[model samples]
Target: MNWDDLRVFLSVGRLESLSAAARALRIDPATVGRRIARLEEETGTALFAKSPQGYALTEAGQRLMAHAAKGEAAFLAGAAEVAGQGGPGLSGQVRIGAPDGVANFLLPQVCASILDENPELELQIVALPRLFNLSRREADMVVTVSAPTAGRLLVQKISDYHLHLAATEGYLAQHPPIRALEDLGGHRMVGYIPDMIFDKELDYLEETGVSRVQLGSNSVSVQFHWVAGGAGLGILHDFSLPHHPGLRRVLPETIRLKRSFYLVRHEDDARLDRLNRLAALLSERLRAEITRQEGLS
Candidate 1:
């Protein structure tokens, strides 16, 4: 009957792990387990089947979820409206998953700006080389390189960022000339490991007409630094180049790639005003960063 109890139930159910549920809620794992037990006892039924994989909902828990989810919607809507009345500041947590490049270069700045404006809001950034599974509740929202065509989801293309071939000036001076894409094979190339590219949109070597990678990493930051360390020519975002003065564009006119970032969330969650506001803020920041890099801002 307690709405707060439903909050615990939904978190545990969606995350499917007591520890993860606790982490998201900012509560002790023992507290989360106890709350679930209390909720099940109140309903006179076992709400979950406990296992090493964590908790799986019982038939009763599944039935209760529909109404609980509706309650959650109402609660979030009320919170959003109330927060708007006071000001545009947000409360509660938002977890965003993104690629290493954006996460390392952009998100920390964005989060700092957001936190400055909203001291009460909580933000978690998961920067990984692999794709985040939104369906599994890995993140409240995800920034992905490509958009999915099929899903009961809300998707928006946040930005189209450009990548250019680059290398340390010393390396460029010493290496074989890349007169053309055909000449790329004569020089050492650094790139994402072919099979480790979790997102197909990140499969950039083929677009560059260069497949012979002498050095590689799944982590873009590592690859960029390796290039800066004079390892080899690499494909790096134009926006990220300014920070590495030693790294010069190898052939900006020839080897280039354009990739779009898509923000996605479950359709039902689109109703949460806090989430939408955060997404809009991120979208605005992403576009502005690209423009700033282009010297258009």
Candidate 2:
């Protein structure tokens, strides 16, 4: 079996979808399907079960993955060792998946520094609404608010952030006062739709008997935009609040909630020289951004 085929199989197995694996590998979906088909032919057993939701690994596929993962690690380590003997002008692309908030507010400075230092390196930043699959290599690195549970992934807590309830002064003036958490019910509150991590935060408010929220778009930017436009009150990250002059924190201390941001990468990618350097640079830059924000506040 070709090592390339194995790589494709591993990606598909982790993501459970040919299309997603294809996108991660920067290849076409047809190529992903063909590689998996060839692998199955060589093994003389079905590796996956096709379903409407996505592809799932079969019993044999699961067993094959153990060996594939080991091989992949060995290959990457050897490659890195060889590459390390060369000069520092490493040339390659690093794909990063991050939340919209980070993409908009935090990553520009990081990007600038990465480009400044590694002029030969190319960086692709994919701003996603949710976490991308690092194990599948959908992203070389990920910045997320939710903690990842995948065993094959390496996660680092980059920073801690707080969220606060916010509203336009105009909106607050026209509507009832929001002195207490319960008083939030009297006003139209813009919030994330159900079944997202943001919803979990909103649910926390609901469980506290603060259930007066109107479902808004899932995008945090969208929710905050509405609040800025005087649509309604919504919870926003503390870092995001300073950018909008009209919006003010309604209950800065009492209604604050804290969450952590993580920088996650696949364990298999740890040995990639280019990836490691980029990850280090990103982590350092993000920490600096957090410190800067704290100083400004």
Candidate 3:
């Protein structure tokens, strides 16, 4: 019944590791283990199954988790209200889960500006090429290429960005001239690994009838760099082109691809004023940044 115990329980359940929970909580692993034990004893049920693989929640733990999450959300909401009563500046941490391309090329300047404006605010960008579980608190918010179909979530379209086959001037000069899409077949291609394309929108090369990539990576930053290095031509974001002056779009008029970024957040978080403000600012800045960068590209 203790809030402290429930906090520990939630951390362990989400991370599935006592050590990781301890590190996140800034406490020792022994303390986290003791808290979980006390929680289990209070409920008179084993909350987790122990094995070499780490803790797996028991049926009782699963039930407790749902209620505990609601409590945690309420508690955080109250804290935010209290903190915001004194000032407009945001405090505390906000973590974002995004695909590498956005995280790497776009969020740096965007988040930097946010941090500069609110010195008390902290941001963490988790660059991963997989879906984030907002229910488990993998991230406070997520920027995704596609809108999620299921979840208690709010989705907003931030902006529409373009991508096209791009290569360095040096590479284009050395390789066979690409007057059209079919001419792309004569040159090496760098792109996403075929089977590892997690989102259908990301299967950009597929549109060009490129069945194979001469160099493939799941990370957008990697593919962008490969193209920048003149290793091979790849479908790259228009926003990213400003970073490499040597890079030039190939068949720009014919091969332009459009994609949109969606901002996603848990519906429960809508009650928090600070998050609402932050999300608004984030969306506005992202939209402007994409437009500004794409103009330069």
Candidate 4:
């Protein structure tokens, strides 16, 4: 009946582990277990079923989750509004999950400026090579290569950026001349491992008619470095090209690849003014930064 119990329930439901919920709620595991039991007793129904893979929500719990999530969102919205009235800047945590290329080259400057302006804000960037599980709240929001097709989410096209076949100037000077796309075959290639390409958008080499990756890594940073170090030619983002002056686009007229980044967040988060403002700022700055950096490239 109390908000505190409901809060505990939501935490356990979201995290699916007593110890994990305890850590997030800053309580002990035993106390979380007791509160959950007390909540179930008050409602006269078992809300969770224990199994080998932590706690699983029961059918009753599933029914309760919808109402509980709405209540939690409402409480957060109220708290955010109240806090906003007393402050000049946003506060609390905002975690963003993004692929490594954007995380490494794009978000650093954008997030730094955001942090400078919003001194009270706590921002985190999780850079991985694969899709983030928003259902687990792995991040508050994400910058994705493609708009996700399914999920209760708000997706916005953030910006379009270009990639091109690139090689270090020194590598090009020393290796076989690349006059066209077919010329790429004579040069060693750097790219993602064929089987490890997580998204169709990331398959940049597919259209280049290149069949093999002599040096491969799932990470954009690794592949970037391999090319920057004059290891080989590979497809590289224009925004990232400015980071390495020696890296030159190869066959720009024939091998240009354009891709867009999308901003995604939980639809429920739309009610939180603080998050909405942050997301707006993120989109605006990222778009501008992409333009500025790509201009330099």
State model 1's lDDT.
Answer: 0.83
Tens digits of per-residue lDDT for model 4, 90-166: 78988999999999999999999999998889999999999987756789999999999997899999999999999
> Which runs in model 1 stand beyond 4 Å of their true positions?
1-5, 22-50, 57-67, 83-86, 90-92, 114-122, 135-137
- The candidate scoring highest on TM-score is 3
lDDT of 2: 0.79
Q: How close is candidate 1 to the true structure, as a TM-score?
A: 0.82
Q: Ranking under TM-score, best-scoring first?
A: 3, 4, 2, 1
Model 1 lDDT per residue over 34-120, tens place: 899999889999988999978988899888876787677677778777767235677788889989898987788888888898899
lDDT of each: 0.83, 0.79, 0.91, 0.91
Judge candidate 2 at residue 19 and give its lDDT. 99
TM-scores of the candidates are 0.82, 0.83, 0.94, 0.92
Each model's number of backbone clashes? 0, 0, 0, 0
lDDT of candidate 3 over 42-149, digit per residue (tens): 999999999999998999999999889888888888988776722678878899999999998899999999999999999999999988988778999999999999
How does candidate 3 score on lDDT? 0.91
Error of model 4, residue 225, in angstroms: 1.0
Q: After superposition, how far is residue 113 of candidate 1 from its true place, in Å?
A: 3.7
TM-score of 3: 0.94
